[model samples]
Target chain A: MSERALVIERLNKIFTTPNERVVALREIDLQVKQGEFITVIGPSGCGKSTLLKIVAGLDVEYDGKVELNGQQIKGPSLEKGFIFQEPRLFPWLTVEKNIAGDQSLKDPKVRGKVHELIRLVKLEGFEKAYPKELSGGMAQRVSIARALLRKPDILLLDEPFGALDAFTRSHMQEVLLNIWETNKTTMIFVTHDLDEAVFLGQRVVIMNPRPGHIKSVLPIELSFPRKRSSLAFQEMRRTVLNEFEKVEEESYTVGAGI
Target chain B: MTVEISEKLSEPQKKKINWLNVTYPWIVPIVIVIAWQLVGSLGFVEEHILPTPSKILTTFGTLLGNGELFYHLTVSGQRVLLGFALGVGVGVLLGVMTGFSRLAQEVIDPSLQMLRTVPLLALIPLFILWFGVGEFGKVFMISIGAFFPVYVNFFLGIRLVDQKLIEVSEILQFSFWGKLTKVIIPSALPNILLGIRLALGTSWLVLVVGEMMGTSAGIGYMIQDARAYAQTDIVFVGLVMFALLGKCSDSLVYAIERKSLKWRDTFKG
Candidate 1:
């Protein structure tokens, strides 16, 4: 359980256009032990999504290296699953078929796994429904199920429930925590929400933007089935919020170079 | 629900509903027909130039009784169907090819665009010269007319499929064929169906013009033949048949679209 599952060393990324170049990430270093739940909290341009993309092997045009299970990631593989802010479910396919994806699970035994996933996601009754027929939360659940179908060692989610309503977003966070507890898959969840970071992550990586670097790593000591109304939860959230403000002020001052 | 709504209506509202649902549609046709009948009976208009509705109906009955109308209709219908099938097949195939391959688009798109811009009806002269007054000539003309709309619509449909959906396919590690069949085609289907609907109309229009040249047994020929003898009633009957056929084929395409797109959560009411 203590074995390192992912390693990122001095990761840097830049977006080059015809007229100018914008640095998106700079000197981002991260490490994750097996089955660890890590949340990345940052402002909009803090490169949280970019960091996740690099780890998922979706963006390979970076300066540093990313390794999963001691092997360098060259491109996307079934070993790691990636989920975007949008569900991105195929509208033309039924819910079950969308989760089944390319139907690469040709083994008759593997077909049953889709049903298991449907049950796991608590979407058993709506397996035949299309994406458009689903509510926002249900659709994101389908996206989660699709990413989990291959049983990836690591799941990279970029603001998966960001588009959901406040109630649905909190509910989905608890659902995600339950899944993480049961599946024991390493998860790197990225979000801009302070409470979500404190509530979900074993360690929340607070990031500040300008060039995008990690500012602090805060470990949450709360137990599972955590109550949001509890004093400890409020304290944790306040602590994270205060750290967030300090980082923002520091970045503002540093950016102004005064 | 209907009873409650009806009960709520005032006298004026009731009258409005009656006018809108039952009486409004018939007003224009009734006025036109009565005016036409009066003009014909009073000799205010020449019979040869403007036949009354009754005269047209009488010509329609005569044509139906003699089986001439059915023969011409079936001939025209056959040409439209054959040309429509060939055009749709070729258009969809090329659309998929160009959509999936940059090389195919680079090589084929320019020529297709140039061909599409030339008025399809204007090519009737060239078609007659090449195919020489045969069934093939008319069918070929109809095929050309049907092809461009389907090709252009499908190509755009394929292009407009959301990028996020394709990214999911990449993350899933789908093979090239898997992406094409599962993601590409299904996503592009609504537009493809629209293309087919549009193609059907073009097929009917081109079939009429194609039949005008070197054809003896079609609705287009019937209208042309009647024009020489000033049989205005027969020409009216031919025009009616064209409208009916066009409507029937359009409904057929709509039915297909409804069946294939049942998964869509579009507005039903």
Candidate 2:
């Protein structure tokens, strides 16, 4: 019913070396609606991150089409925000400055926006603290705030909480959900964690490696603030897990045959 | 009970340790000065060969009172400051140019590296011949000396900027100038500061050589003039001035380093 925010059709990516050419992704077609939250999950070497990178226009050497709102993706733009696995906060910049980033903090509007984002990320007291001074989780939160400051059309997160501890990772997930609810921006989250996939995504895209492609898309009919302990939540998670395991077993067997 | 007693004893001992930490660096220099004074006063060494510490102190007082020392210090300071400024400006410009452009790096870097290999003092005769034995020649020599360290460090710094950060800049849609000022320069600041420190040290060294050759003013000139009159105490005073000034300049840069690089999570020790 909603307008399409992104359309990826017959997308393929290849990495070539002097020795060999490897297929990173193949025939990856997906459609995302405006304000939709999609989680892509797969095993290692799945090229899920590569897919996100392609969509962000950081990797332009791909076949087929990735159109964002009817325009072909050419290169990285302010409209597409990307959060890498690492926090990657500029060490010299304070929390406020990192969020403000290239935008002059001298402007009252910019300062207010940075402050609001900081508060949104629950980093209220760390405006003056440099990246090195903040904890790992705090640094990542600053990065999230920084990405949100640009008010991008779509935010692609590549396992942004992969390095965090279980507790912090869960907390960050909630924080991310809160940001998504407030902004209502389209999000395509890539993760290896099944719990994360089932928890955050309106739809979970299960990917298979060895010429990575989408195996299936499972839409969650569950409500917001879905409990991990709930029977319905467990059933959905189990279904995605089964799909994920099937791909893994198939890839393993294929490798063995090779 | 024994633990409590040990803790009570350690409290005063901790205070003593703090006092020792403050005084530790000065102890050796003070002891050496005292011994040197003792030897000089006993006439163990000829005054002409090695003047007494008290005699050197007296010369220092005379130089200070007559304002000659201040004048010479000012001359040397001016030359170093001017030359260092010129050197830093040119070095940073070239460094930035070569850093951002591969074409610039390829065209300029190899030639610069070749030039850097030559001992800069060897250029003094050529400088004298080209610019004459004027203040220009001396300043030129000091500037050349200051240039290489800065150029090398800044170039290396720029090249060493993290690739991930560059991607972040790209993602932010930073304009060329924005990327340079916001990302590149700030990332390379530690190296640039290091280059500055090295350049400052080299500037002083070149200043001594420069003044010793042609200049009739400055601490180096004062030393040369004293040598002619066999005023060994005055020579010692010049040496002392050089030492003090060098240390002072180094400390200034160190203070800048401390202030600017507070964000670095480096080992304190």
- Compose the digit string of candidate 1's lDDT tens values, residues B127-177: 877879899988887888788889988898899888888888988889988
- Judge candidate 2 at residue A243 and give its lDDT: 84
lDDT of 2 at A51: 96
lDDT string, candidate 2, A1-258, tens digits: 399999999999999999999999999999999999999999888899999999999999999989998999999998899999998988988889998889999999999999999889988767877787678898999998999999999999999999999999999999999999999999999998999999999999999988899999999889999899999999998888888889989999889335
DockQ of each: 0.36, 0.32
Q: List interface RMSDs for the candidates, in order.
A: 8.9, 10.2
| Range of the 10 consecutive residues with the lowest summed lDDT in candidate 2 chain B | B4-13
| Alpha-carbon DockQ of candidate 2 | 0.32
Name the top DockQ candidate. 1
